[model samples]
Target: MTNRAGRTGTLNEELLRKAATLQEALPYLRRFAGEVFVIKYGGHAMGDDTLAKAFAENIVLLKQVGIHPVIVHGGGPQIGRMLERLKIHSQFVDGLRVTDRETVDIVEMVLSGSINKQIVSAIQLAGGMAIGLSGKDGALIQARKLTRSKADPDSNIERILDLGFVGEPRHINPDIFNAIDLDAVIPVIAPIGVGKNGETFNINADSAAGAIASALGAAKLIMLTDVAGVLDKDGQLLPVLTPRDVLVLRGEGVITGGMIPKIETCLDAVRNGVGAATILDGRVENVILLETFTEHGVGTMIRRDDPADGEGG
Candidate 1:
C-alpha cells in the first residue's frame, strides 16, 4: 500500500507541475490577446520535418489563443539545390545572389510555389487556416533594385555593383492582411516583390518581414535562425538588449557578417514602431512557445530603451 501511494503521489506531482506551467502562461495569453506576431521562419529549421511540424503547431496554438501570426520564410538552401539540379551556375556578390533573369524565375518558383505552399499545408494540417502569399500579391511589397558599393583595395575607389533583380522592400501594404480574417487565418508570405517597372525582384526574407512587421505595427517580430541568439564575447547568450547595446556590439566588431544584417533588421523594426524584436534558435523544438509564454525566454530580445520589457533569464 505504501509503494502504491508513493507512485500515486509522484503522478500527482507531475500533473500539478503541468498545471502550474499553464497557469503561468495565462497572463501572457491575456497580454498578447489580439496582438500580431510576425515570425521570420528560416535557417536549418525549415529543412527538418519534425521541427516544421512543431512550428506549425506553435502557430496554430497562438491563433487558437487569439494571437495573430504572420510568417515569412526563406529558401536559400532549397534554391541552391534547385539551381544545381538544373545545372544553372550562380554567383553571389557581397552575400547577395546576383540574380539574373533566369535565376530570378527559379527563385520565385522555389519560394512562392514550393516553400510557401509547403508551410501553408503544414499549418492547415495542424488544424489552422493558412494562406500563402507573395509580396507581389495585392502589391504588398513594392520594391526597388538593391545597389551595393564595394571599394577597391588598391586605389580605395568605391564602385556600385548591380545585382540584377535583387531588390529591397521600399514599402509594405498592410491592407492585404486586413482582407483576411486574421483571427481565423495565418498568412505565410514569400519574399518575392514586384518593382515599379512590373519586374519581379527577389527581396531578402528578413528585410521583407521587418517591413511587414513595421507596417502592421506588430507586437513582436521574431526571427528564427540557426544560431542560439546573440552571444557575448564568452559565447553566452544575451537575453535582452537595447538598440544602444546592439550598436555598441556592432562597433566593437562583435556582430559581423550575416548577423550584422539580421541585427540591423531587428533594430529597424523596433525603431520603426514594432513593440519588440527577437532572434532565437529555431533548431530547438517549440522555441516560439519557450520565448513567448515562459519566464525564461530562449533568445535575445531587442527593445527600444525599455529594460523592463520582455522575458528575462
Candidate 2:
C-alpha cells in the first residue's frame, strides 16, 4: 500500500509541475499574441532530426497561440557537403563563401530546393502550414555585391577581395508579406537574393534574417545558433546586454570570429526597430519556449535600453 501511495504521489507531483509550467506561459502568450517573431533557424540543431522536430513543434505552438513566426534557415554545412561530393572547390573569406557563377547555381539548388522544402515538410508533418520560398520570390530581397578589403602584410596596401556572387540585402519588400495570410501559414525563407540585373546572389543567412526582421519590424528576432549565447571573457554566458555592452565586448576582443557577424546582425535588427533580439542555443529541446515563456530566459537577450533603464535580458 505504501509503495502504491508513493507512486500516486510522484504522478501527482509531475502533473503539478506541468500545470505550473502552463500557468507560467499564460502571461507570455497573452503579451505576444498577434506579434511577429522572426526566427533564424540553423546550426547543429538543423542537422539533428529530433531537434528539428522539436523546433517545428515549438513554432507551431507559437502560431496557434496567435504569434506569427517567420523562419529564415541556413544550410552551410549541407552546402559544403554537397560541394565536396561534386568536387567543387569552395572557399571562404571572413566566413563568407566565395561563390562563382557555377557555385551560385548549386547554392540556389540546395538552399531554395532541397533544404527549403525539407523544412517545409517538417513543419507540415508537425501539423503546421508552411510555404518555402527564396529571397528571389515575388521580388522579396534585392541584393548587391559584398566587397571586402584586406591590408597586404608586406606592402601595407589594402586590396579588395572579390567574393564572386556573394551579396548582402540591399532592400526588402515587406509588401510581399502583405499578400500572404501569416495567420494561416508560416513562411520559410531561403537566403538567396536576386541582383538588380536579374543576377542570382548567395546571401549569408544571418544577415538575410536580420534584414527581413528589420523590414518587418518584428517584435523579436530570435537567432538559433550552435553556441550558448554570447559569452564573457571567462566563457560564461551573459544573459542580458545592451548595444553599448556589445560594442564594449567587441572592443575587448571578447566577440570575435563567426560570433562577430551574428552579434552584428542582432544589433542591426534591434537598431532597425525590432523590439528585442535573442541569441539562443538551438540544441536544447523547446529552447524557443524556454526563452519566450519563462521569466528568466535561457539565452542572451539584447535590448535597445541600457541596463540602468531596468530593462534586462
Look at candidate 2 and tell me the lDDT of residue 220: 91
lDDT, candidate 2, at 229: 95
Q: Give the clashing pairs for model 1.
A: none
Tens digit per residue, CA lDDT, model 1, 154-269? 99999889899999999898889879899888999999999999999999999999999999999999999999999988889998889899889988888889998999999999
Model 1: residue 149 alpha-carbon error in angstroms: 0.4
- lDDT (10s digit) by residue, model 2, range 1-26: 47998899999999999999989888
Clashing pairs in 2: none
| lDDT, each prediction | 0.93, 0.92
> Scored by Cα lDDT, where does model 2 land?
0.92
By summed lDDT, the worst window of 10 consecutive residues in model 1 runs over: 304-313
